[model samples]
Target: MLGLHKKWCLGICVVVYGQLLINALLTTNKTWNELDWLDILGEGGTALLILLWLYFILAARPGGRVTNLMGAGLLAFFVGVFQDALDEIFHMGASTPWHSVVESVASPLGMILMTVGLYFWRQEQGVVNRQLKKREKLFRQHQLVDTVTQITELNYFKYHLRIALSAKHVKRKFTLLLLDINQFNRVNQRFGNAEGDRILHAISELIMLNLRDDDLLSRYAGDRYAILLANTIEAEANVIGQELIAAIEHFAFKTLQGERVRLAASVGLACAREDSVDSILMRAKQALALAKQQTNSSALGQLVAV
Candidate 1:
């Protein structure tokens, strides 16, 4: 995460330095009597709060579109608040057009940008929440989260699948993709379960990276994973399943001893119908059985679409 956000730190430094330069150039000497105490308190407080916000945002979030938006917005906010604070300390003559522009224009523009950024941030969170729903039986509890993959387990996946099945606006056309690593047991036997656990964790991260942010991924038990793709058709699900299979097949995970271990995955794709989540899962399981059968005959497993 530090490596991901190193550039943002540089950008923030630039903004801060630029603001300091502006303050040095434009600010005037004002006596304590000339400064309005109430305005100083208000503007200084606001600026401090914005600075804290900027620090938190950069420190907390990874570098991405949403992070960029919020960072730019926070920068704008700091600039606005800093300018406002300067208005309290500096005695800028009415003839100066620049100070007036900073005083009048910066705050609202910053607010507008921040509002826009927040809107996009909420949209991003919606996608995250959709994915989180699959891994959580109840939204608020953190105990149910899988410690290894940082996803949910089978019980949580089932609980939410049922809710999705019963939603009024349900498409009745969702898909579930189940992926099981071929020869996962051999990795444990060869390297040990600790190494195997690391491999599973790596594989789960790879699968999540390939999937849409709204798609749900969970550890179904042991080496199997289940994904819930809402509003997806069988054809699309097949494409996704195939992509997952290909991705896992291509992934070269390194063992602690510096040996590379390539893995192949069997994938099952099954579309939901006007039936219960249990029935849908059973169909996916059946598809997985076919995929495993095919894997036994070939070096790499193919996606079995049902």
Candidate 2:
């Protein structure tokens, strides 16, 4: 991603500098006396603003529809203001009509494109906000989040689970679910590690979307996730596991080459007992193994009691 933004920055620099050079060469007879500080301030400021927009758009988002449209709009605005700023410093004479046309048309057209881009961006943000609402109550430390999956790591998850388990006189049953992506190594081998990470991230989002607001989801390790279902029994946990498995199976994740890959999840469920966290986790891991062995015939792994 850094490489992608670096290329964009280089392209912007080249275009802006190249436009200035061309303007300088064309204004062969111009004197420094023609320079207007006010015009330079206005047009140059606009150019700077357009560059800022481009930087924010590229830096904050992945390449997608909103980014593409916003990038194009900013590029158009940059080109427009770049020309206007040059025209103020140079006497283009007979070529001034073309310059006026470009300056007049490009900025407005760029604004219209930017408006459309902003509308789509708002829609995208709404979806993000809803997802955040679901996960925010479970945990709220932004710094401890995993970069690749954008969820909490295993340690934080364990910390919370231990707290929930120790609470006295809670009527609701607490269950732990551990899910491993079946044949996930094949995805990395076939589509490369980057695509495989994308798939894992997508799967993590899918799991969050399917879970209740009270549930805590985290990346346990490579190709595995740990979920804490507060106030859920084994029967209810099994149902949630099936839903997650179905969601992943139905998800048509595509590779960079536009090839769709189907996915399967093997889940293990274990209810909390009067034992240490390590013991409960071991039970879930053992159940997960059983679930993986049964993945061919069952949609979800077997539920094991402690």
Candidate 3:
């Protein structure tokens, strides 16, 4: 992730270098007896810790306005703290008032930027939380999260499926959509497993983006996604399934090596009936198999004609 934000990293490096140059040019080294070891230890250590935190933050998040703002704020704070540490070993003559300038200006500027960044971060989380409402249905289990897609696992989906079946509501039956990515294992064989995992994650996010606010999504089997459309009927869910298939058809996933990988999705659509979880799943699976067969035959026809 840090490698992805080269411009931000480069800008911080420049600021640090400029500060070092200014300090060296304007300030003279203090006498050995004049150096305050205690101040150096405290201020210097703090600056070091902040620098590490900046690195971790950059590594964790993608490049965006919020990330940029936070990185810039941390860098500004680093400059001020680092300059304070320098003050203990360097003589800040009357002509060189940078010590006062850095302490008074940089620290406050950093704080202000950080505060603004946090405000935007909160708004971002609100959107994410709304999306997750359909995912958990007021339930949470950290262990059920999938390693590849970071979505909930099959067991979690099954848990919710059983509940939806037993509960009596105006809309007694919910639509279940199972999507299997075509030739997923082939992707792992051609590219590395790491690249395949990235594709899985990408496809999962794409599906989530196309779903309604009240739909639950989870990882099922190796490369299949199970979606519970709580508020959607079979006809509406069928349209959504076709939309998902079309979306995947048009998606051009660029690999780390610059190769473009176009993906296809086969969706199985079924509506819930009674408390029969196994039957519902079996119907969906059968539908998915039929869809896959059609896709293969179509591809084969195209190749023969070409």
Candidate 4:
């Protein structure tokens, strides 16, 4: 079946071949009991879903240049996910070759492809829904991506938020998670804005990795990011939010001068209600404020103990 899609399949097959060769040269297999089965399930499940989507994309679409381009983009995502699931079975230590290379490159490459696809998809939808009105002026493609963080800008996020809200079903629910980086300005003052910008980019990438692909991530403003999660209730959003926070916490970012930086994030959760964008944003802002306050208190207590 894949043989029919030549170009699309070629790129993915090459990546798989290289990955296999690298693993053969560098990695050792973990014992059955030592493997993290749960993590494998999560990562493998994601890969399976991407593969299924790829299959549907090929099966449903007619042969065309656009279809092949989309297929190639989807293949990048599949490779990234496939690599992640493979990591669970192999005990690749800190010295693993191409460990950082493939993930750092492929995932973002796929993300950019998917994001561009979303923009074109939105433009196509705009023709069908002229009611969007003045909102079209805000979406100038390149302008919708943040300069520093490279995620979608606040305006772009609002655009997607409108779409998500409008497409809402009576039975289906979507939730929003707002996250603020703790003591971000202090990091800037201490390590210069260059380092701070790098941290923002890293945090943004980390948040993206934790996302379910369907989720929307945008830089709400400085040191703050917003995520729109589909089919999520408050409880599920809370779990996902915590996972993001944990991912940020565990990320070991280093400065130019060899200083290790510890990062923490506070999340505010809000679910869609009455389909009002402003209303949901306000709730998320309030929750974020409260979370920041609690984070501040915890820091204060730790300082006092010291």
Candidate 5:
């Protein structure tokens, strides 16, 4: 969509430039200062737009040889635009050495910067290609599954759960932790949806940092998150719960008004026996309800058994 829009805009620019050239030729006054502010603004604006379009294409497109070639084309486009914009804004008469020097240097500098950007872009694409190959096996496995979205959700749960259950089934011990942001709706109501989104992203990053690579983390619902721990009993889960509570307690988030505001989370944990995933999740939710029910709770955090 962006590419198409850019092409249409470039076409309009060509038409306007053609009309301006014809007018310049037909009129008696052909001097440089005869150019109006409207012409300079229109031509300069078009040049800037072309440069912007080139930058977006190189920066945002997926990595590949085709993208590399497109990036090179963008470099050429930038050179053309730089020269055109300089011509519109400056009078490069035969006597003005500085004006000629500016005109000569602008195009080459644009080309050099664009070329450097493309080189790094190509290297970045190589890294992306390797990562894509690693994910290909998982992608194929996903195609065999009925629900791809569900499998993605289950990736952080079932994958870890299988390892945990296999290692500790004989002992019949494990725990599930559920964490929810308190008064999250109030943030959206008071500030705006954009502010709410930033809070959610920040909280998610914080939770992810606290977990082991082997642990499971999932965004279970809006303002709610779940974690499944391996070989962890109710007491151990409670200890982890306290650590999480401390982490959030120490966090100070900045509001839209540039004021510092503190936020808290309510957590619930449940120990697992010979239980299925659904059962464990249900018990964890119940524990979370109990935590939220506590009175005079500076911060709500609790642990319970299934």
Candidate 6:
């Protein structure tokens, strides 16, 4: 594309150069000094436009071949415009030896700058093409899996509830598990927000890795996560909950001061009933509250029937 643009610029320069030559030789009725103000404005305005385009391309699309080429082309085109604009305002007569030399230099200089910019633009396009190819592959893989819909919170609950009820006909049940990191606010208060964010990301990844492919995970709230286990019974859900507790218990996170901080999580599991999604979530939350009250510590897990 940059090559095409450069070629178009070169063509315009050739046409403009021919017009200047013809006007110098045959147009005896108009003197150079008699040039209209509009003529000067037109030429100067074009030069300014070319310069602005060059500036934007350089500033916005750095490290790209098309941008570099367009930048160079604009640079060359501006040179011609500069000379033409000056010719309108100043009567640099054809008889002056330097006048012809100056006018002749603009076209060639513009062409050279444009050519160099196009070369870089082509190199940048190659890199972009590779990135696009990788993106295409990722898109194809995503099509094969059942992905969650990005919707409002209310809609998400409604949709998941419908799915759960439909699955019950096939003897498939769902379990909801909520995990809250203990004293997470203290970490933010003591270490920093950056450390807290890192810890959250690490724990989320661990939970994701341990879950079945059909399980859904979401950031429930600050320091808390909700997991939706598909086709899971209460007994199986308890086993999974135990594994998650053990995994988090064994994880050794380092503080900003390089001290190892032991972290624990409180888990609440609830089996889904024929009721709404809201009811299931509320029961799980109540169970979590009970666990926290009974144990008086973060490292607690409970399973409550809804």
Clashes of each: 0, 0, 0, 0, 0, 7
- lDDT by residue for model 6 (143-231), tens: 32212211112334345556676664757778888877767888888878888887887777778777876676656667777787778
**lDDT (0 to 1) per candidate:** 0.82, 0.82, 0.82, 0.77, 0.61, 0.66
Quality of model 4 by C-alpha lDDT: 0.77
Best by lDDT: 3
Model 4 misplaced regions, further than 4 Å = 1-140, 300-306
Question: Clash pairs of candidate 5?
Answer: none
TM-score of each: 0.57, 0.56, 0.57, 0.53, 0.49, 0.49
lDDT of 2 by residue, 1-306 (tens): 545666667877888888778777766545778778898899888799879878878988887888778887888878888888877778876765777787888888888888899999999987886777545445478876787898888888888877887888568688999989888898899899999999989989989989998888889999999999989988889889888878888899988899999788888888987857898899999988887777757644343333
RMSD of each: 7.3, 8.7, 8.0, 22.5, 13.0, 11.4
**Cα-lDDT of candidate 3:** 0.82
RMSD of candidate 5 to true structure, Å: 13.0
**lDDT, residue 142, model 2:** 82
Q: How well does candidate 4 score on lDDT at residue 53?
A: 86
Error (Å) of candidate 6 at residue 179 is: 1.0
Instruction: Report residue 137 deviation for candidate 6 (angstroms).
Output: 18
Structure candidate 3, residue pairs in collision: none
Which run of 10 residues does model 1 get worst, by summed lDDT?
132-141
Report the C-alpha lDDT of model 4 over 1-306, residue by residue, as the tens digit.
555676655665687688767776688888888988899999989987887887787776666555665676777877777787788887776887577677667777877776676566567557744433222233457667789987788888888788878873777788988888888899999999999999999888888878874677889999999888878887778778888878888889999888999888888888887857898898888888888778887752110000
- Please give the ranking of all candidate structures by lDDT, highest first, separated by commas: 3, 2, 1, 4, 6, 5
What is the alpha-carbon lDDT of model 1 when measured against the actual structure?
Answer: 0.82
Error of 1 at 272 (Å): 0.6
Winner on lDDT between 5 and 6 is 6
TM-score pick, better of 2 and 4: 2
